[model samples]
Target chain A: MLILVTGGSGSGKSEYAENTAVRLAKEEDLPLYYIAAMKPCGEEGRRRVERHWRLRAGKGFETRERYVDLKGLALPKRGVVLLECLSNLTANEMFEPEGAGDRTVEGVLAGVRSLAEKTAHLVVVTNDIFSDGMTYDEVTTLYQERLGRINRELAGAFDQVTEVVCGIPIQLKVKGSSVI
Target chain B: MILVIGGAFQGKKEYVKKQFALAEEDFADGAVCGEEELYWARAVLHFHEYVRRCLETGESPEELTALTDRLIRENPDVILLCNELGSGVVPVDAFDRSWRETTGRLCCRLAGEAVRVCRVVCGIGTVIKG
Candidate 1:
């Protein structure tokens, strides 16, 4: 099953996604995996990553750092995988030296699709950065556009899509509800 | 207590006015209202701005918690409208980061005490809790 969990920063989406991964892993006895996409750039970035580590310290997830080219990452088949975010991944693909650059949409979609095929329960966490209503530079706007398309496409393909607000889950889609 | 939240320009004020039948004068503007005005206001708009001002005055997180506690104790029926500010990219400035996190935490606390919590999107309110 593919589940998309999205929310604003500090909206508790990370914690929610972690707990969900743990639950699914325990219930199905699957190996829990955490794919960290954010490249810890500065002090703040490192601190944020450490905070997440502390939150899931004893959750039994085997961590994998994949900054770009996610389609090549190797994982055990049928394991429970939690991708902490798509925002950072999208940026990495757009600007990183070895990232997809202009082909970010296809690159990211292919990576995610590959992960879904390899995992038993895939819980993907993404950001809700589009609603801020701030104008940005051309490159930043392109990044937003690309990420927005990625989110919409994945939401349609995934089994469930949830938007967490103030730490509460607002289900935007559910399994087999595509017809509705 | 009631909590209403959404992104900026999402018509939160209009929804509150229509839903609660509150007039313009019944609301306190958090952006410029005196701090004391919160204690007795019927409803507050831009509550996130109020939080920013509190932080700007060096109000510690603990003190802010106490102030909100007093708000609940003094006026349980007050309604709050806070923009969902944490959805954007993490700000580069230190103050901006803390401000965003602090507002989010405060809203979480308020949501817990609130008897009703509604999230607005495009001027429509969806009750997430009651």
Candidate 2:
């Protein structure tokens, strides 16, 4: 199953995804695999990610920080896999002028699609940047635009699409409905 | 939707807590709300932790939306405290600019979800949305 979880920052999208994945893993006895796409830039950044990981995984599950080569992870064919985010990973890997290159958004979307096709159950987390606001700068405008496109594309492919608002899950797409 | 917004280190946090306490007192005769402070701390941690996680995992927007929805569901009468990160000059670095923009977007989204929104300035609360 491919699940797409999206929301703005501080909207509780990460916690909700983590909780959902953890619950599913516990109930189904499936091995949970977390694919972290963020790169730790500094001491503060590293500590913050560690704290979130501990809070979500509770100190047991393994975590792999892979930003660029997302397709190489192989993501075990039988368990649950969570791509915590795609936008940041793409941003970090394809930084600056490179990110502005063609196929950046498409490449990320294709990666996500391939992962979903290969995995057993996948929970993909992302941000919903469209309803938030307009981007103020060039780089941000590019990122936001690309992210919005990626989100729309992934929403089309995923089995379940949920938006986390104020820490609550509003299911946007179920088995067969378009409105979430 | 009591929106409590201000810049960093402002008194919005304290004011929100007081308002929460006052509301509790008015409604339930001082019945203590256990999760107010906890939520505030969570909010503070949530901001940085979320950014860090996003940087690490490449997750999407759903995580944030789900979190906010859950919080609102749990406490409809929530007093959200948000930093006004966009009311200043744009940053020179890409990372700094993105951080500011992301936080500003999140705060705006939260205010929209709020039934009542207030901007706290100089320790005084002003309603911005209702």
Candidate 3:
């Protein structure tokens, strides 16, 4: 089961998703995994990552810093995994790595599928990109288009989709077959 | 004054029209904007485009921000429609990033003075302030 949560910057979706992951872990007594998508940078980057670390701290989660090839990573069996964010992951997968040539929508979707197959309950938190209402240069436009496509695909495959705005979670899609 | 906001093509305009009983003639498309154009309009749509246009005319975001702040303040009966741009990922280009920042600042200014603020998502309006 996968739960997709999305919102704009500072919209409080991360907090909501984190709390949801914690709750799910408690209910099922499954080991919790936090898949950190961002690579740690210098002072500024450390500060941002620290904030997220502090949020998940003491929540019984083991942090796994994985940026690409989610299926390649060795995840715990029957554990609940929360991927911190999909935006940075997408950017990393699309831009970084030697011979990263696979920036297409199919590439990201494949990774997500692999993670889903490995985890018992997956809670994925992502960002909403198209709401800005501005068409950008070719590269940025491609990034936005790919992110939008990834989001729609996740919503279609996942049992639940929620958009958080102003700290309020608006349930957008529930397939009725969801247990979490 | 009230401010209605939403993502692109999320029905913010239609919702505002139905709720306020406003017709097509009541709105002055803000893209061809001027002090004269907004003088007596019942409401304004595409105000974001207006800001973008203002930027093209060599005006700074701060200048437009001040201008819009005054416009919303003086026109108590006017209901403004704006797209909430700050909630998305920051743009990569210098120009687009500046536009996004400017629009966010302008919306913040309008939201500060407006009596009501409603966000429309999936055609559902949630009143965040009033």
Candidate 4:
């Protein structure tokens, strides 16, 4: 099963995803895996990683640091896996040394596709960072455009989709309904 | 005035455009332009930015409140679009806190006077007022 959760900065979507994955793991009697996409290059990044570490400290999640190439991740054949975020993954894929030359929007989507196919239950968290209604430079605009398209695609491809606002989760897609 | 709000990239602009037939020229961004020029806009998309500017310029929220009143009085069909209530943890910075608080208050004031209010989620609009 593929679950997509999205929210803006400071939203509790990350915490929500973690808890949801934990619950799914327990319910399905599967091991929980935390896929950390961030490279933690700066102080803020490191602090964020530590904060997340503490959040899932006792939640039984084995962390896998994959800053790029989701397709290369080797997860156990079947288990609950939370791709902690998609934004960082996109940035890394777009600019990281490994993907710099060959990566495209569809390529990133394909990477996520592989992760979904390889996992028993895939819960992905993504950031909805662009709708500030402010125009940006060409590069930022391109990034936002790619992410927006990817988000729409993910929402359609997943079994469930949700958007978290101010710590509240609004179910955008649910099983057996075409509402989202 | 009509208030339409949704999360980032939730198709709020597209919804407004398709629903109200508001062309790009018809809708003005609040992030740019001066205070007086805002009143001249047919529709002010992202009303929060105007409020942000008001706060930044050391203008009182009351001044914004009055301005919204004048805008509504001048243009009976004006529309406002704001990101729905801050749906995340409170900001740590004093300026951010004030901005969020002031934006919330401004949205409420505008909504209070709005003829219709709608919350859009996932391209779906739910009428909260009117």
TM-score of each: 0.89, 0.59, 0.65, 0.62
The best candidate by TM-score is: 1
State the lDDT of candidate 2 residue by residue for A134-158, as single tens digits. Answer: 3567877777677778888878867
In model 3, what is the error at residue B108, expressed in angstroms? 14
Q: Taking the tens digit of each residue's C-alpha lDDT, what string does model 4 give over A1-180?
A: 789999766556788899899999999899989999888966756866897899899999999998877777788657899997888887787777786434557777988899888778889998876655566677766777777788889888888998765455678889777744
B1-130 in candidate 3: lDDT tens per residue? 7888777788888888888899988888887767766656789888888888888788986688678767866677788887766566675565665675577556656666778878888888888777
List native contact recovery per candidate, as a fraction of 1.
Answer: 0.54, 0.02, 0.28, 0.00
The model with the greater DockQ, 2 or 3, is 3
Q: Which of 1 and 4 is the better model by DockQ?
A: 1
Residue A64, model 1, lDDT: 96
How far does residue B104 in candidate 4 sit from its true spot (Å)? 13
Tens-digit lDDT track for model 3 on A1-180? Answer: 689999875466787898888898899898999999987777746866997889888888899998877757787577898997888888887887631345557767787788888888899999887765566788787888888889888888898899875455678887685432
Model 2: residues >4 Å from true position, as ranges? A96-101, A131-135, B1-130
Count backbone overlaps in model 4.
Answer: 3
Q: Summarize candidate 4's per-residue lDDT along B22-99 as a digit string, tens digits.
A: 899988888886766666776777777877877887987678778878888887787777776354333446567567
Interface RMSD of 3: 4.7
Query: RMSD to native for every prediction?
Result: 2.4, 11.1, 6.9, 9.5
Classified by CAPRI criteria, candidate 4 counts as: incorrect
| Two-way TM-score contest, 1 vs 3, winner | 1
Model 4 chain A lDDT-worst window of ten: A99-108
lDDT of 2 by residue, B1-130 (tens): 4556655566775676576654322321111223344243322322433543453455444565566566676656645555655433335665655565555555656766877766666888766566
Superposition error at B79 for model 2 (Å): 6.9
